[model samples]
Target: MGKLTIVAHIKAKADKIDLVKSELLKLINTTRAESGCINYNLHQDNSNPAHFLFYENWESRSLWQTHMNNKHLEDYMKATEGAVDEFVLNEMAEIDS
Candidate 1:
């Protein structure tokens, strides 16, 4: 099995930027501790404060799937219900070199 990479772009509603950011930040610590997590980093766009991106690497697709079902993620989903304006998730596999 090969490693998987995930690029997630999140945009918070204008009025809920702060609340959405706080909720997203909470996923960092917990996600980093999960099994098979190689690296999970979050970034905020300087020009657009409400725009955020997450770059993640996983040992395998299954492990990444497990992460999606994690309790904290579910909680985040619930907590940010309408606060998010757009969410784009992309999964990729490295090409043989």
Candidate 2:
């Protein structure tokens, strides 16, 4: 209904951080171009080479769902099926802000 914010914490396979970054960044760029996207960004952990995070904002839950079903996103997921070792996706809403 309201805005949806998605936070994704991922850990690439050993020594595959760069590969994951490249692919994930491409998907994030494409997601930013989507009609309902509010913002999209990727961040790396300072101490952990294999850890990365994706922060994304969308107009609504429905729009976020659409982004999840995007062709490019699907392709990215397929490509990283084996390359990715761990993933944690969290969704949220701003309670007061």
Which candidate leads the pack in lDDT?
A: 1
The residue-by-residue lDDT of candidate 1 on 9-97, one tens digit each, is 99999999999999999999999999999999999999999999999999999999999999999999999999999999999877865
Error of 1 at 28 (Å): 0.5
TM-score of each: 0.95, 0.93
Residue 10 error, candidate 2, Å:
1.0
Q: Count residue pairs with overlapping backbones in model 1.
A: 0
lDDT of 2 by residue, 1-94 (tens): 7899999999999777788888888886678899889999999998997898989889999989988888998888877877888999999998
Q: Which residue pairs show collisions in model 2?
A: none
Worst 10 residues of 1 by lDDT: 88-97
lDDT of 1 at 93: 79
Error of 2 at 92 (Å): 0.4
